[model samples]
Target: MMRLTRRTEYGLMALAWLARAGGRFHSVREITENLDVPRRLLAEILKDLSQAGLVEAVRGPGGGYRLREDPGRLTLGRIVNVLEGPTIFAECYQGDCDLSPRCTIKRGIGEVARRLEAVLEDFTLEEVVHGPAGAPAPSPSS
Candidate 1:
């Protein structure tokens, strides 16, 4: 089954936390303490986000990381890409298979991956964590 990796999951959680923090810098310590994510891993993820221009980072005691772009405008696909490259729904999607020359499932599975990616591109981070108007996000089961 398709699922998010731990690294990508943590990235999303950290972004959601920063979004809830409003327009203020929050240190890694504070983020780690609250989110319970590992400091080292979170640091690496934040660096990637910062390099990707998704987050603004500052050094110094009072310096921290914050969203560079509005969360409402940040797509989930973009975030996932920044943190984890791209979505791979199945092995055949990568084109490394020896069976690619005559693979029957490759085309169909690739289409599904593309469609799912389009959905991700349209769904913003804010909407993912909070419903349209600050309503609690509905679980996938909903």
Candidate 2:
């Protein structure tokens, strides 16, 4: 059941698209049209990503958005955090459970969440773009 929200998904998709396009500034309209994502939602997600310093926004005619840093330097975890805030696998893991001190389940869940986050942190945006060469680009829907 662990899944990235639609916002994060679209953000990554847009980022990957930008990466493939090689640092080109792509307008929101172009992104929405090519990616089949909702225009309003993509705008909000792009804004969030820009605010997080993950993407850069340019204004005026012929201006648009592009990645603020190299794709190889951007981690998936960071993008997810930007779009969705901190990733927490379980509510009880946030020290909210009355039985936290004695709950074995909470401890196990925390470990799993940490491991998952670690995996995400290790995967950079570049890995998503190139996709082992001849392999087809991984679709966001996957």
Candidate 3:
């Protein structure tokens, strides 16, 4: 039962909304009201996005958040990494678990995580938000 966490879902939703804003900043209140999301949660999510360089934050009056990364080039994998850190098998993959000595799927779990990241990288924000007609997202520069 693999699925996106609430934070990733809300973060992705906020990004799509901001991308559609055509570069104009949108306050957390505005996004929360429009998307029916929790204000405090959204603010924290937005702060994480801002710190990750995905969105730029303008402080004070007449200020809010605007998309900074080019949506056309941004990959879902990158977003997930920023919001949730690297996808991995965690302790099991690191051989720190009690069953690491006999875990049959430990190696397989690492492979699954890598494949998942690659699949996610195949699509861009534009493709995900709009449609899948565009070419694959360019290879990550770094």
Candidate 4:
């Protein structure tokens, strides 16, 4: 099964929180305390997102982090790419596979990966915050 690392998961959670907050600058302490994420790790994730241009970091007393773009413009795939590098669906599809030219399984997995990527790309941060009716919002507590 595919799984996102805690870093990516928490990063997305934090972004969703910021989006829900309407792009307000929230400090690391506030985020960690409210979301129950580890402060140090969350800080690193915020730094990475900021460097990727997905988040804007503010300095000084009342400063913190906020989304750089509108939630509707941010895709899940882009966020994943920023936080976790590239999405690799299978180890055998990494180009170093022993059956690189002969494996149908690799091709199939690659196709699935592409489809999944497309779906992820289609999902924006806004969708995550609101979710579908009856579906709970994405939150650290949930």
Candidate 5:
């Protein structure tokens, strides 16, 4: 069963929180408090996002983190890739398959991976923050 890692989930949560802030900086403490995420993990996730150029880290008294690009322009796939690396959600495709030499299901797994990517590609950060509507309200309750 494929699933989003805790790190990716935290990254998305942090992104949506920042998105709701409307370009304002929010500290890790604030984000974790609002989302009930762990401080250490959330900090690492934010650092990864900052290094990936999705969010900018500000330095000063009010310094924190801000989105580098429009939330709408950022894709879920991009975020996942940044936090988790290129994911197939399966070890087989990552060259960890011990049955590769005799496996007959590789082709089907590849197809499944492609379909998953296609679906993920359709979802943008904006959709994650605001849903399908142009603007409503951010839901970081998750």
Candidate 6:
């Protein structure tokens, strides 16, 4: 039952839309209206993205949001980490686990999470918005 949280989904969608604008400032209202997303939620997501240094926010009447970094270099894993923190494939992987001394598969699960992160890091924002053919996503080992 693993799936992306709403915050992550909205963040990605907003980023993809912003990527389409070619770094132009896009207002929250504009994005919400076009994407049919909740205004408050989108605003919060944008704020998180802004704080993450992924997007730049401009103030004043002619202000909005624009991509600060190149989408082609940004990875989904980086965005997820910024919005949702690190990915935990298993609860026992946490260092505070009481059974850490006797636990088995802990390292294996850690490896799973690590490999998953590596796979996600391979995908850039440009590939998310456009086609994967634009740039090759990295493999689990790469």
Q: Estimate each model's TM-score.
A: 0.84, 0.84, 0.82, 0.84, 0.84, 0.86
Q: Report, for every candidate in turn, its global Cα lDDT versus the true structure.
A: 0.85, 0.83, 0.80, 0.86, 0.83, 0.83
Q: What RMSD does model 3 have?
A: 6.3
Q: What is the lDDT of residue 5 in candidate 1?
A: 76
2 or 3, which is superior by lDDT? Answer: 2
- Residue 102 Cα positional deviation in candidate 6, in Å, after optimal superposition: 2.5
Residue-wise C-alpha lDDT for candidate 4, range 17-113, written one tens digit per residue: 8887754688988888878999999999999999999999999898999899999899999999999898777777677777556666876777787
Name the lDDT of candidate 3: 0.80
Give candidate 6's error at residue 81 in angstroms. Answer: 0.8
Tell me the TM-score of model 1.
0.84
What root-mean-square deviation over C-alphas does model 2 reach? 3.6
Model 6 segments more than 4 A misplaced: 134-142
Error of 1 at 56 (Å): 0.5
Candidate 2 C-alpha error for residue 111, in Å = 2.0
lDDT string for model 6 (1-142, tens) is: 3588998998898898888766468889888877878899999989988988999999778789999989989998899889888776777776666766788877678777778778889999888987756564332120
Point out where model 4 deviates above 4 Å: 91-96, 99-102, 133-142
Candidate 3, residues 65-126: lDDT per residue as tens digits? 99887898999988888888876645676656676577777767877767766898987887
Which 10 successive residues of model 4 have the least lDDT summed? Answer: 133-142
Candidate 1, residue 41: Cα displacement in angstroms equals 1.4
TM-score, candidate 6, is 0.86
Model 5, span 1-142: residue lDDT tens: 5688999888897898888876578788878888889998899889989999999998777888999998778988889889888875566666678866888776678778888987888899889887666777744553
Q: lDDT per residue, candidate 1, 34-96, as tens digits? A: 888999999999999999999999999888999998888999999989888866677898877
Tens digits of lDDT, candidate 2, 1-142: 6777888888888899888776568899888777888998999889888888888999878778999898999999998888888876777777777755666697578888889999999989999787765477654431
* Candidates 2 and 6 compared by TM-score, better number: 6
